[model samples]
Target: MNDTREDMANRVFLISGGTSGVGKAIATGLARLGAKVVIISRSADRGQAAVKEISEATGNSRVDWFAADLSLQSSIQEVANIYKRKYDQLHVLINASGAVYFKKELTAEGIDRMFAVNVLSHYLLTNRLLDILQESGPARVITVSGHPRFLKNPVINFDDIQMEYQYSAMRAISQSLFARTLFAFELANRLEGTGVTSNAFHPGRVKSNLGRNAPWYLRVATPLVNAFFKAECGIGVYLASAQEIEYANGMFFDEKKRIIAIHTQFEDGAGNRLWTLCEKLTSD
Candidate 1:
């Protein structure tokens, strides 16, 4: 599973949230492999700084960045258009942008902040770029998921999807995780013969700014939690560049690259329901 510069040279990878956390780590890894890496960030200044840092750190000038607010469908569409116009090929698309909001809020589009970011954004962005992905045949769509243990009994309450009645930060976060994973699986099934594979993986407990919007206590505890769990980008890099799993789709892999069986709950039409819901939420 070793990727050489020669093997990765000129290969294109587009990563959402590439300015931080697992996204930045994977972007760096890909850049180091000699691939053309494009990352999406919400802030122009931060995106430029990240591009410079990753380029300098990896010594790969091919690293680049684009600014976009993933929580907004219009923003995602605009960025995707810009990306397609600038790049002719997209070898890999990594949906790694995520966040935790201590307070329940809605985006301008009237979607829950957490769900819009963690779930709908992935759906819209990926679908918007599907043509390019298929054109770049043998491409991959790698999504970021939480720990398998937390997802063992995944549930999506379509009735109260926005948690309009009773909203806890944890409930919102959990629902987003489940919905995104379902989207990944459902995407794989739909792209079965398109030569574009889709899979989800846990990036482990990576040291990240995921808790930046959380309560003071949780934000304060982030550093301590990160001290014990480092950002592990091996699986992300592997899934993006691995020759073995080039066609692996509808699968879930752990941080160690072990394929875990998808829970039966996900197979019972939930993926379809989630996909339909996303289609409605993100409809132009």
Candidate 2:
């Protein structure tokens, strides 16, 4: 399908973390282009509010939302099942759901918080919906990844991926981002002939709630940092809607322009190992 804004009209878009920040911004922009958008959030009230606000702002009443924690495998599975039951097609999937913890935490499933939401949820949900996306054809999957600068080594540490022994908030978050990038590349490779494009992008630093759980100093400095350097939600809108990048698969982007990060391009063997590990971890 062509990338014209009018083409997006009636197209089905599903987004996670669309209640606020970059996710919400992307949802609003797509809704403005007349797409039928369904957002998933942890809070029903927040989800409803976001749907109403986006609908009112875009003058498109097709906006709706579902409630899901997204931090548990069961929740992710149930959400995907509900979506599949209602929608037969998914033209675009924007995975903007992410979180950073000030300290190491585990979900009800006993998985690391960073790994569960930022990494595992993206893997499971996208995989579950792959059939619909493939059937729809010419679909796009855009996952919001972290900046390359945050990852120094970008190793998966198969010995202790969840960092049960040497856990640190920063390290856990960084590894999750790297895993996300790795999964994006691996997904692109697997979906090569499926007419589905999978890519990852760094939205730059934005003043959002992603840091709400971080140190007080970071919370104080987030606004100042954003004032000096930050990418607005429009960057996400462009990647999700621009026709020029319809075939740009397996690439990473910063500020709407594709750039190669050396760390993310690990040996093919490493990527395959990571993919296998993810499959095992997310398996029922």
Candidate 3:
């Protein structure tokens, strides 16, 4: 994926969770290619720092950023509107913002933090920006899926979405896996021919601090977990650089060109159902 960005057709990319790790890696790479890149994160200082680093390294001042507390629907709306006014022609959206904690917690809006950040926020942001992406035509929507999907059963008790009964690290990971992946499939179906496509990527486990928000037990256990994994960043480039990036919508990808099986929760009906839930939940 190095330097193949010379002939890009005026693409503008919006990326969440861009302050560090995979997001920053991908953003810098894209900006180097002359692609307009926007990095989204929770802190304006962090987002701007990333933008400055990306711009300095790539020598492309086209890199920009928007800060939002994606865990809340209102912030999602605010940032999406800011993006619209900044970039009139949108081409790709990377829904990479995510958080996890050992204990279950709720956002200020009374939504579960894990579910809100990992699932609902992306759903709302993507749907809100659907029109700009459609207008950009041949746009791409890519999000990150953790390899934990294969290691765990991604089943959520829809009757108890708040996880009121049981809450654990494993439980939150499972629910996010199911909910977000299902949303990806449904989102693809919803905008199949509008010139926008949605897909998810599993950035191979890297030495990043994904478990930063987890409890001490997880913090002590992460090193053991990471031992079984490999480097992750290539997966980002693969998702961003695939030859058929436009038509390769609604698929799951790993580091290279390999396609992973969609989680068992991904049925056509489930996709639409999740989309409907998203719309109602985020409607002003």
Which is the leading candidate under TM-score?
1
* lDDT (Cα) of model 3: 0.76
Please list the residue runs of candidate 2 whose C-alpha ends up more than 4 Å from where it truly belongs after superposition.
1-4, 222-231, 261-264
Model 3 — TM-score against the truth? Answer: 0.88
Candidate maximizing lDDT: 1
Clashes of each: 0, 0, 0
Estimate candidate 2's alpha-carbon lDDT, on a 0 to 1 scale: 0.83
Instruction: Order candidates by TM-score, high to low.
Output: 1, 2, 3
- RMSD value for candidate 1: 1.7
Predicted candidate 3 versus true structure: per-residue lDDT over 1-284, tens digit per residue: 34546645377888888787667777777776778788888887888788888888878888888889999888899999988887798888888777776788888888888889889988989888988988887778888886644635456567776687877778777778778877777777777777788888777665555888876887898788768755346767556655566587788887665787774445446666666666666662
Between candidates 2 and 3, name the one with more favorable lDDT: 2
The residue-level lDDT of candidate 3 at 144 comes to 80
C-alpha lDDT of all candidate models, in order: 0.89, 0.83, 0.76
Arrange candidates, best lDDT first.
Answer: 1, 2, 3
Choose 1 or 3, whichever is better by lDDT. 1
Q: Tens digit of lDDT per residue, candidate 1, span 1-284?
A: 14446879868999999998999988988888889999999999889999999888878888889989999999999999999999999999999999888898999989988989999999999999999999998899999998899888888899888899999888888889998888899999899999999999998767798889877888899889878866658889999998989989999999989998864656488888888888887763
CA shift of 192, model 2, Å: 0.7
